[model samples]
Every structure is written in C-alpha cells, then in structure tokens.
Target chain A: MMHRIDAEALAYSYTSGQRVLDDVSTHVATGEVTGIIGPNGAGKSTLLQLLCGLLSPESGNVLLNKSPLEQYTDRERARLVAYMPQSVSPAFSLTVREVVALGRFPHLGPFGSLGTPDHEIVQDCLGQTETSHLATRDFLSLSGGERQRVLLASVLAQEPQLLLLDEPTSSLDLPHEAAFFRQLRTLSGRGLGIVVVTHDINMAAQFCDRLVLLGKDHRLVNQGGPSEVLQADILTDAYGSPLLVGEHPQTGGPFVTAPVGGI
Target chain B: MTLGNTRFLLLLGLVSCAVIFTCSIFIGTETLDLGQAWRELRSLTPLSEAPTLSILLMQRIPRTLAAFLAGGGLAVAGCAFQALLRNPLATPYTLGVASAGALGAWVAFLLADVTAAIPLLALLTSKQVMAFLFAGLDVFLVYLLAARRIHTSPAVLLLAGVTLGMLANAGIMFSRYLARPDRLVNMDRWLMGGVDVLGYQPVLLLAVGVIPCAAVLLLQAARYDQFAFGTTLAAGRGVNIGRLQTTTFFVGSLITAVIVSEVGPIGFVGLIIPHGVRLLTGPSHRLLMPLSIVAGGAFLCACDIVARRILPGETPIGIITTMVGGPVFLYLLVRRRFSDWNV
Candidate 1:
C-alpha cells in the first residue's frame, strides 16, 4: 500500500529570528524518490527536517495519511518516518550490530529486550546495506564511507514507510555516492517513499523521479519531473550562477555543470 | 544484549562481590574466625559472652553494608551523569551539584539546634532539605550557564562546574575556619569522606537514598545507552530527549546529595568505578550500569578493609579511594590517549 505525507504553505525561522524557509509546500509518496536540491543556506535541510517532524514549521502543518503530524506520538511517527542524520558521533564504542538494534526501540516493549525477530531484522538490515561483514566491528573505528553505510543500516532497521535522509552521501567518493543512490532506488522499488537533501543536482536528476528545487530566497522555485525542473535557466536562477545544462554523452541523460568564473 | 555472555559476567561479578563482602565483614580490627562465627550463630544466649555475635551485629555488618550501598549509589549516579553530559570524566559531582549539597549539609550540622515551625521541614530535618535545595540550585545554575544550549562546548561545562565546585569548597573552608575549636575535629572528619560509621543507621540512610534513585537510573539504562549516539540521532530512534536529560540530571544529583549528607562527599567511586566496569562490559549500559553497581560495592568494601589495616588508626576511605583510583585513572588516560575523548 502507498503512504503519503504533505506539507502545506510552510514557513520557518531560527531562534535568532532569521527567516530560513518560506512558503514551501510539497508531497512525498511511496514507491517514488524525491530530492530537495539547493545551494548553500537555502534551507533544504530545514525543509527535509520539517517533513520528518524533526522541526515544526511556524506557519504550516505537516500531514501524514491525512492527519496532522503533531497528532501522532513520537514513536508512532518514528515507526513510519525514519530519518538518517548527515553525521553521527558515537559516544561509546558500540558494535555495529548494537547500533543497528537501537532502531527497534519504538517497536520493543517498555522493558526493551530485543527478541529474536528484532535481531533477525537488524541482521537483515546489515545484510541489505552490505555491511554484514562489519557487524561485529566497532562503529566508531570505521572510516567515513563505512560509517555512513553502517548508519544507513541502522536507519533501515526501523522498517519505515517514509525514509528522509539529510545528505546521506555527502562524504562519499564518486563510486560510493552512486552506490548509495542506487541502494535508495532499490528500496524505492520495494514501495518506500524516499526524500533526500543534497547539493549534487545532476546526481538527483539522474536518480530521483521528482525534484523540489529550492531557490536562493529559500522559496520553492519549481517542482515537477526532472526533465521539467532541471532546465538551464531554472538551475542558474536557483543557484545564483551560470549553470549550463546538457546531455551526458555516456548515458544520454540530463547532465548539469556550472561555469567557473575564470573559465 | 546476548544473555549468554552477560549471564556469565553477571554471575561472576555477583560471586566476587559476595566473596569480597564476606571477607570485608570478617576482616577488621577485631577478627572473628569462621568457626567462631558459626558457633556464635549456634549459641543460645542472646547477648551473653558472645564477642563474635556482638562485633558482627554491632560493627562489621553495618559498616560493610554502608560501604556497599554508598559505592553502588555513587557508581550508578556517575554513569547516569556521564551519559547526560557526554563527557566520560563527569562524575556525580562534576556539575557541582554534590558539592553544593555537601556544603548545605555542613551548614545544617552547624544549625541543627534551630527549630522550625513547618511540619514538613522539621520532619525531613534541615540537613536533608538544605542538601536537596542546594543541589537543585547547583543544577539550575549549571544548566543555565553551560547546558541550556545542548551544543555547549565540554571545556565550558568543565570550567563552569569546577569553578562552582571550588567556590562551594571555599565556602566549606571559610565556615571551618570560623567554627569553634570544639567543632574543628568534626569538620575535619567530614571533609574527608569515610564509611567509618557504626550501627545500622548509615546502612538505612544509604538504602533510603540509593534504592529508588538507582532503580530509576537502571530502568533508563537502555535509553542512556542510546545517548552514546548523541542527542539528535538518539531522538531519531523515538527517545524523548528532553525527558531523559531532565530525569538523569535531577535523579543523579538527588542521589549524590543523599550520600553527601549521610557519609560525607566521597569521590572517585563516582569518577572511576563506572569507567573500570566499562572496560569489562563494553559500552552497553544494561551490562555497564548494574555491573558497575556490584563492582563498586565490592570495591569500596575492600577499600574499607585496607583502610582499617593500612595503619594503626583507620584512615578515611575517601583517601584510600583517591589514592587507588587516581593511579588507575591516570593509567587509563595514558593508554587511551586524548584521541578517544571527542570533547
């Protein structure tokens, strides 16, 4: 079954009273991949966090399955909307398996002993993320790429219907970053709604079914399919730069590049 | 969370704690052999000529139990505070809560004779009420200054806490200097923490303070373990971050205050025992927390024995814990290096 989350005309500002996001609205549905793409200080991260109930918009409300997001308890919302942070600092030397098992907390009883089925799910997530070999290793000792994968596995253990990620591959090399997006595509194939915030516009154009382009003013510039939203004029206007859009010679897909000033 | 290894480790800890507890009860200034203890237990007379029975009933059991409960309480409080503060060096007193509580207790002793008209205040006594209030004041100030914002630097927290702690300690010293000559010895004894208590009052005092608070902490052990991943990530897993942090600070500080009022402000048990137990049990709080309690109890019991035997007169157990734990803490730091501490 498909699940949906909608945001009405949302606006938000930080505690310092600086307006960061304004009049933004979007919807994400299962079996589809959406990307929130923008330049620095565009509040893409803030918008994604609002969608996942991490931050409440000052003016608008988020709806999950036609009910207000705030109406649901934290555990209820968490069981459906799983969020993966950009980076994490492990306070203790927990094993990869232990870190993954924590995702089952919303499902566990008050006593919180992970039963065999919970362990099995954790093991499956590790296998799904291809980190099974590192399950017994220390989470803190892993390299940046490996740590992101492990953290992704931990988020997957939540069995969420809607997965919201904030720069999930920001630290990866090219191959690993592509691999991470491909993994997301596979998960979306299994009827999951995935929303990601990233700086890589061309990568989003290649992977996401829909693009929510945020402009320099932190407002929604455009929202539609990649072919409609990834035009040269919209790209340049959103990024405050002269970005040239063209076809990838290899894949015959949308390829975007920004012209450096000296060039 | 695997039961196999955890069960074995727990059983081993329990056995060691029990053995050491028995030895602690038996080894003291007046030694009673096992056979004599057995005979005393078998004796028919209630209080006649049974030195073993009197010593066991009057001295050893109470003293040992006091050490056990205080050590257990301090260790659990330390674990909770460390998790909340995200700093491994944090103890029950790191945020200055217990120091303020101790200073309140010292003043309460000076003002013991004053009668209060309020029934509730009179019932709980000035020392306990003052200790709790001052501990609360310390948390309020520390939270306002250092932890009101979650992302405050660790160096700021350390500086704020240690500076406030020094001020409270100075208050204690100033009061000590102005005190009458007759009160000097009493002030000196309390300044150095000890379990040289006699009778069941200390044990009862520690149990009253430690049991419920420790239970609250143990119940939140799994939640605290999730805190290792930091607040934002932990909250992503459905943890109510606000509730957890509030409970940890208040409950941990209250327990620290209770011990401070009862047996003076003992240190190092809170600072080092949890870290030592973490080495054995890894970082899972389910294992690290309870095991620290058992290990801490056994450790302090043993320390009491050493304190009794180290010199002709019993040195304060606080001196022994610092003497012993200081070296161990240094060794741990030297081996682990500054790289391990993100703060």
Candidate 2:
C-alpha cells in the first residue's frame, strides 16, 4: 500500500486508573474514508488520538507507513498526518489568512518566510475548503461551521497523506454537515486517507467506505462495510439503546434512527 | 497589515521614539538649549565647564535612559507574559516578581544590619541582587508546580503565581516588623519605585540585563503569534509548547526582576502599554513586540517628566504611571470590548 496506518492491540489508561481503550486493533489505507462510530465514552476520541500519535499507546504500538510512529521526528510525522481536534477558541483574533499560514510551520525552516509557492499552496487550501473569501476576516468572528472549514483548511495546508478529525461536524448544522462529508469524500477520492470520529450513525453509514464500531467496553464490536456493521443487533449492543436500522430511501445505504419506544 | 504598510508603520514608530527620547533630555526640570546640548554631547567635553552639560550628562540623560529601558523592558515582559499565559489580565507582575523581589530586598536589609563585618554577607545587602534572587525563586516555584500537569492551563499557572505573590508579601511584612524603624524608610522608598539616577551605572546594568532578554523574546515573535491560538492547536502547528512556555516564563520574569531591582515595582506600565500598542498595531507580536518596547520606553520617559517637573513636588514615577495609566487602560478596555477589537 502507498500509505497505511496500523495499530496493533493497543491499550491506554488515565492516571485515575480508568481504562480508556483496551486491546484495540485497526488499519486504515490511503484512498478510503474510515468512520469510527460509537456511543459516548467508548474511547472513540482516545482511539483517534492514539492513531494520530497525539497520545502514545500504553501497551502496544502504532505504525505509520510501516515505521513505528515513535521513530519519526515531529516535523516528519506532522507532514504525513494532519490532525484537527475538536473546535478551539483562539486566544487572539488572528485573521483567517494568518491562522491558515500557521499550518506551514512544519514545512518552513527556522526564520523562513513564506515564498510564492507556499502562498500558492495556502491559497489552494483556502479555495478547496471554500474559505478564500474569508481570508481577511477575523477567525473568531466566523460562525461555527465557517470556523470548522477554516480550521480544516489549515489542516489541509499541511498536505498530509492522512487526515484525522475528531467530531469535526459536532458543531455543524445539517447542511454544513452534509457538505463537510461530501468534501471528505472528494478528498478521499483524491488519494488522502481520512479517519473521522463521529456520533451520527446515519451520516457515517452514508459516507464512510468502512466503519469500525466500538462497544461500551472499548473493544471493537464489528468492522466492515457500513451495510454489514450497521445491523440493528450490533447498533443496540454498542449504543446500549434500541436503534432502528433500515435502508436509506434515496441512497440505498444503511440508515439508522433511534426507536420511538424504550430499549 | 500588508507587508509594505507594516514596514512603514515600524519605521514611523522608531522615528517618533527617537524624537521623544531627544526631547525628553532637553525638556526636563531645567530646559537646556538643544544646540548647546548637541554641541556638548558631540564634543564629549568635561562636565565641570558647562552647567547644563554637567546636569544633562550627570543626571537627566541617565535618568531618561533608565526610564526608557525600564518601561520598554516591562512592556516587553508584559506582552510575553500575556501570550505565554494566554490571559489578557496577565502581566510581568502576575508571576509575583514584585512581591518576591520586595521580600528578597527586605531580607537583604535584615542581613546587612546583623552582619555588617562580613563582605560576602554584605553582598546580600544589594537590593538588586536580593531582588533578582527572590524573583528567580518565584519563577522556579511556579514552574515546579505547573510542570507536573500533562497539559497545564493558564488558570492553573496564574493561580500558582498569585499564591506565591501573597506568600512573599507576607514574608516582607514579617521582615519589616523585625527590622529597625529607621530601615523602614529605605524599604518604603524601594517599594515606591523611582527612576533615580546617579550616573550610567544603573542604566548600564539595566541594559546588560534587559537587552539580551528582550532580544530572545523578539526572536520568538512569530511563535508568540501562533500561541495566540490555544496551546494544543499551536503544538499541532509544530511548536514545542513545553520549551516555549518555560523559556518565555524565565526570560519575561528576568526582565521584570532587572527593572524591579533598579526602580522597585513600577505599576501599570507593563499592563497599559501592551494593550495600547495592540490597539495601534494589532496583536501580531512581530509588530507588537518592537512597538511595545519603544512605546513603553517613551511613555515612561514622558511620565517621569511630569513627575519631576509638572507635579507639585518630587512624586515617584510609579505613582504618575498608575494615575495616568489606570484610567486610560480602563477606557481602552471598555471601548475595545464594545468595538471590533477582540477582548
């Protein structure tokens, strides 16, 4: 494979003796969108952090491009994997352009100024993320959806082969959510591997090429195409509540909904 | 700002600072003619012949320079503290530099009283050395407390600093109670903060301390800009957060100690100047740092003029800064919150 990330039987626990993840294993290849879906506290966020090397695995290891993640320098690893965490409020009102330019830090040498080519790449990212018009606008003044797009543009500016997003659409409304996933699909088609931690099962089923469902005990319940993983029995077990699973009326993919009655 | 415009603004800022510096020397308590002063300055003449020259060289020049250095140094430290702590309310004094330095100075006074014969122990009596040591101790304590957390928040660090300051203030009070009543006058004078100048010695000492620290801070201006985003985001952008925070904390506090050693604790210049500069030049430290330094220096020098000349008597320079800066900063903060400027 051109680019692949693998985690082998990984585990982690916080200092308070609460286990966040246990013996989890997964692999994501380039040109695919992998959706990680589970109920709250299933260690979905923790797993994503481990995969991106933001948090080291406690008992196992993560391999990026066939090399142990710990072996790569921060600069080299950043160029290979760009991570966009949950939404953050900036301490100062930096312009969107200034915020996006920060993504070039890993690429630029010490005391290096942005050159013409770097500017072109930044502009390209802004355009792709549809934030070109907001370049001069203050980042703090933007709407939640717009802020997500600008921050995503910052991640894209790194030009990583793999993109890791945690709850990227958590703050987005319906239209923005759909548009964001469509953009992710477009990026995946363009040969960038995307791994997203999301709670919306219907959207995950609709967009993801593969889905990894984590159960309440922080172990993988199932991993397959969305059609196979989004079964009613598995959804109920993973979420600890009754869920209605059926075919999408328009897209012919698995669609999930919460049952009106109790579990 | 666009590149060309920012360059122009920076150049304009430097020129204005130069004009202010020159005018401050001439327009002090004794107004000396500029031409004669320039001739004397250029000639390097002996101080005994020209009375204006003697006062200018012996007193006003060094005093003005000290005011500028301390003001600029404090402002730069303030900007670094605000950025490093990610809090607008944070200043160089937030980490207890003033209180700790005061405590250290008190201890020095006590030691000087008890051990008048020992030369090495006598060295402890220098307010500068005592203040520096206590300031260093404060920083070390804060670092020790905050570094234990995996992701130390600004609030945590600020809390640690405030607690340390309160403790140091308590120590100073105890020392004052134990010492002779006559020595209380010296302690009180040091606490009031003045740009008292004898010759270039104090100015030289401040320069040797402030310049290198300010240079180190200026080099990190772009990184400071990145830190405006929260720490985690900045780290994802390739900044080594731990190293940046530690270096900035020590250097910023070092400059504060250097200034406090020279002129006690000059209140509000550090807090006021950075906020004012942000309004004028925006929050990018690359522009903000140099401008803050120059503007802070000029601001203090002008304030010292009012203290020496316009005030009824010899008012301490720190008093004038608080009197002027407190209201101006309050007005700016209120207006900024309502205006397009980000809080």
Q: What is the lDDT of candidate 1?
A: 0.84
Residue A38's lDDT within candidate 2 is: 96
What value does the lDDT take at residue B223 in candidate 2? 78
Model 2: CA > 4 A from native? B33-52, B113-133, B136-167, B332-343
Error of 1 at A224 (Å): 1.9
RMSD of 1: 2.5
The residue pairs found clashing in candidate 2 are none
lDDT of 1 by residue, B273-302 (tens): 888777778777778888999998999999
* Location of the lowest summed lDDT over 10 successive residues in candidate 2 chain B: B334-343
lDDT (Cα, 0-100) at A128 in candidate 1: 93
Q: Which ten residues in a row have the lowest lDDT in candidate 2 chain A?
A: A104-113
**In TM-score terms, which candidate is top?**
1
Q: Which 10 consecutive residues of model 1 chain B have the lowest summed lDDT?
A: B333-342
Least well predicted 10-residue stretch by lDDT in candidate 1 chain A: A254-263
